[model samples]
Target: MALATVRFDAGQPVDLEDSLLGGQAHRWKRASHPELVEGEWYSGVLRGVLVLIRQHGQAIEFLSSSSDPQAMIPRIRDHLRLDDDLKAIQAEIAGDPNVAAQVERYPGLRVLRQDPWECLIAYICSANSNIETIHRNMERLSDEFGEPLTLPNPQGEGTGTITRNAFPKPVDLAEAGEAELRRLKLGFRAPYVHQAAIAVAERRLDLAHLVAAPYQEAKAELMALKGIGDKIADCIALMSLEKMEAFPIDVWVRRALADWYFPGQKTPTNRILLEWAQRYFGRYAGYANQYLFHGRRLRDRKPAQPESG
Candidate 1:
């Protein structure tokens, strides 16, 4: 397929690497065929379509598996939330010094809008697991049950091809059974993933409806599912259910808040922290949480060492 470009308003800036490979989603990887593209390239399957994207200054160039690549512009726009006014959101949440620093540091970071069913199961597998482990688990689940696709080399006809598996549908996992999921190394999360899939596949849970529901209502519904707690529920809400104000308090966020917001005072419960964040950041509390969380993680990570000549 031919490559296509999607230009955005200058006011909207996106750091594709930080946004895609950042904690919000786990499917994307730095393109292995970087010699064929300019800037940084990422390859991932979004809602079953294999997409290759690269940041070109303020705009992005992309290639996809669709018959008409232009038809994917809307999906790509919606997925990256390209229309969100980053300047305005930063102005609203930057009142805090700590958040302001993060806003300045990672200016192009934007919240991703992921598929609700996929996001739900992804977070269900996230309980007590790190990002790398979550990626492995999700990849295993997809490989085990999803439909496989092959793409010819973008550079033109050749023997080279790329293989990927789409994220499975609810019915796929529902029928796979927990034992089969455990074989993928999902551990205790296998049952939760299975039950959640069954709920969606059987129509007992309507993930689409939650998108239009109130933030609290959507969060409550997600929390009703097994293995979903306050943090995971907020994750599903913020990333997929259109609840931008849902603040997910995890370890990194907890530490940031403790050091920056509650220095000498004892740390409050997660419930209180969530309430405080919502009240402080108002409608964009989720954005605030993401910036703080990402910033804190980057700060704690050690720098790479230089290679000797």
Candidate 2:
């Protein structure tokens, strides 16, 4: 099990810590140096893959247990969105002065392209919650239903004692009873997760195909599932399917738009804000959304309810 090291020189725009912890994903947990067998790092299940990630100055590394670890590089790249040029994307979304200022402040914030199935359940669980609770719920879901894997510590010296389960696959959760799912403290979201898993497992929803379909079509299809709405659909489209034009409007985003962009004015409707973003930012509206999201997150320095979008 070799480690795949992807590096960016000092002063490069990508910041792994910001990208992982910036409210976009709730599953990544802070790991200690001894636990990781390296310096302090993070651990999480990316799709079905268990990865140990660390950042050393300009270098970002992915350690996976796949026999061909190099293959995981592209998968990680797509998941982490390392291929997209940050400067170019920022330039595209910086048309709005408020967003431009955010880009400058939050330098390497990028919308991660996560696994569609995992991304779906995650956002579904995100409604009216905080990141801490979201992480707890996700971990419980995985422990109850996901498959297990064994991976070495960073030094290949020994097996680490951190979590070994991956995020549950659709089939894994397809037959999960709502009562059992609710044991994970999913609240009212348990039935929604079961129904969504059934949809995917039964082939009623072909999530993989949607990745290449038109953005609107994909979003419409996602919204058709139980518990999915306009904001949730857009979140899945932008964060999971690489649809850069997808703009998800949630509470933080709404507040950001109201205070930063239109201070002392009437807060526009979600539809109007989204439409304005689509036309103003064009293909990179999602990245713009990240900056505003992260900037506001940092500025407020308080944990807000994680809207399901």
Best by TM-score: 1
Steric clash pairs (candidate 2): none
Which RMSD values do the candidates have, in order?
A: 4.3, 2.6
Model 1 root-mean-square deviation = 4.3
Stretches of candidate 1 exceeding 4 Å from the true structure? 1-11, 34-39, 302-309
What is the number of backbone collisions in each predicted candidate, taken in the order shown?
0, 0
| Candidate 2, superposed: residue stretches over 4 Å from native | 1-12, 33-36, 155-161, 304-309
Locate the minimum summed-lDDT window of 10 residues in model 1.
300-309
Weakest 10 consecutive residues of candidate 2 by summed lDDT: 2-11
lDDT per residue (tens digit) for residues 195-303 in model 1: 9999999988999999999998888888888899999999999999989999998888888999999999999999999999999999999999999989987788433
How much lDDT does each candidate structure score?
0.85, 0.78
Q: Write the per-residue lDDT of candidate 2 for residues 1-309, one digit (tens) a residue.
A: 533444433344667788888878878877655745656668777767777877776566767767767777677677677778878878777778888898777777777878888888888887777778878888888887778866665444555544568888788887777888888789988898899999999999998899999999999999898888878888889888888898888877888888876799999899899998788778888888788777876777555545434
